[model samples]
Target: MDLLDFARGPAINVAMAVLVFGVLWRLFALLFLGKPVDRTIPRLGTPGPFWAGLREIGRRMLPHPTFATAERFAFFNGWVFHVGLAIVVFGFRPHILFIKNLTGLSWPALPSGVIYAVGAITALSLIAALVKRITSPVQRFISTFDDYFTWVVTIAPVLTGLAAVGHVGARYETLLAIHILSIAVLLIWLPFGKLFHAFLVFLSRGQTGAFLARRGV
Candidate 1:
């Protein structure tokens, strides 16, 4: 095979392997190690059923839900950070092309400027969060090694992505290689660290909200 064909095959295979294994490992670990329903803290004043959880998520999403609190800036910043990060990670042109080529699916790509803006915002937000964790006594006390590991792992992809775009030390292809390697490291680390919370957060939020609703709190 030509160099292009050979490179494509291994790139696709490695990426697929990492994705599949990372997901499975996370699923199994959560199944085995995740705390039971009663262990989760529920939101106060929630009402019961699966809908309660849905309502909680809706409240978080909406401009003003019944459970809305006065911490408007915090909520807005957090949401913006998450949404922007998602857009950059999942809506990059190269990523879309890779997915379409490998999986026979495609999505619209974000504009380059928008993607760069999202990357910048997400990186800033992550740094702010890390600082918060270090400076806040309560957060510092609550954080475990896993939490720190998650922060590093999560930040790696963003940093590498920026480096790939900037191409500071090497050719574009070399920067891309570094970016892919960082991503691979993150995938391998995800299951073994607090990064697993990325998946568990949704389920835990839902279950906790539902339970609170049942208690009429």
Candidate 2:
């Protein structure tokens, strides 16, 4: 039996359902339960404090012109890793096909080689980031259990994908099974962990924008 075939059937469906629900639940909770803004930070150029925070977030998201410095390299690598992982996870042909079949919506599919390359790059970048966290005193000081757990959870899918591709330590079916299982675990853990911040970030940014608008600084 094909491992990929197994993942395509009930197991994949269940995992996908859980992932969708978990993400939604966390988002809903954050939307309703998160505290209101206490104070606004002043914007550098904008008239209000809220605009400044929004601008800071935008700056953080953009790529610097050069990666000559360590900070610039880290920022670029971090963003590249996130974008690459998103493309591979959501834009791959099989994933798109599955979504089309399940939800009656279709998206453009990325090429197979590109999907694999993006996954590989994301895996490498995650590893580098984890290493930095472990070796750098500043990062280590700021790191918490959730931070390390998030790294492991985030990296597991990429590593498992590589293993499944390489047919590591077992039959392709077995490796694929492990890969699917890891994804299922990630889905369940996401809502309860720092990974939820993936969605929370946007909400936080919007809140910052709103606060700035109210202040009219």
Candidate 3:
């Protein structure tokens, strides 16, 4: 077996297995920590848990007014890379084919050149985010190993993908192998790290919103 074989086979298979198991484990852990029963009667003239929680989740997607101005850079930068990542992953023909292979789903793809350009832009956004994390005193102080580690795993695939697409730094085959391996690493680490927030953010925000909404706060 060759490098590409290893990356496309065992590495990805194990990473996906770990991803599924870890996500399920984390979710089960949260579920087991059951919410306490709410005994308080909800105040009148307010949307109940379902609507209030949904609204609050949407509301908090933006930074609070108190810090919105201060957080604008980080906020917009985050959205930039996140949206770029989505476009590259789902809009590229090869990626859509990969997803189809895994799940028997297919979608139209954007032009390869367009998706690759977006990948480059995504890489820049990630780098900008890293710089902000380092330069901002409060963010720097609050940051932990997980923060930087997650960032690396997040950016590694993007960087490697660009290299593979450009056929730079190595033979195209080798670069592609590296890119796939980086993604495998990302998948393995995602559920075990801060990256899990990709899924958890909604659960957590909705729970809080439901709790607070019951009190009409």
Instruction: Tell me, by lDDT, which candidate is best.
Output: 3
> In candidate 2, how many Å is residue 144 off?
1.5
Each model's TM-score? 0.75, 0.77, 0.96
lDDT of each: 0.73, 0.77, 0.92
How much is the lDDT of residue 135 in candidate 3? 93
Local accuracy of candidate 2 as per-residue lDDT tens digits, 143-172: 999999888878997898788787778887
Give the C-alpha miss distance for residue 66 in model 3, angstroms. Answer: 2.6
Cα-based RMSD of the predictions, in order?
A: 5.2, 4.3, 1.1
Model 1 stretches with alpha carbons more than 4 Å out: 1-19, 25-48, 60-74
Q: What are the per-residue Cα lDDT tens digits for candidate 1 across 1-217?
A: 5433433456546755876788787688767885555655555655556898887666556556543574454566778778877898789998788668768888888898788888988989888888877987887999999889877877777887887797767777766766766666676676667766667777777866677686675
lDDT of 1 at 190: 67
Q: Whole-model lDDT for model 1 versus the true structure? A: 0.73
- The alpha-carbon deviation from the true structure for residue 15 of candidate 1, after best TM-score superposition, in angstroms, is 6.0
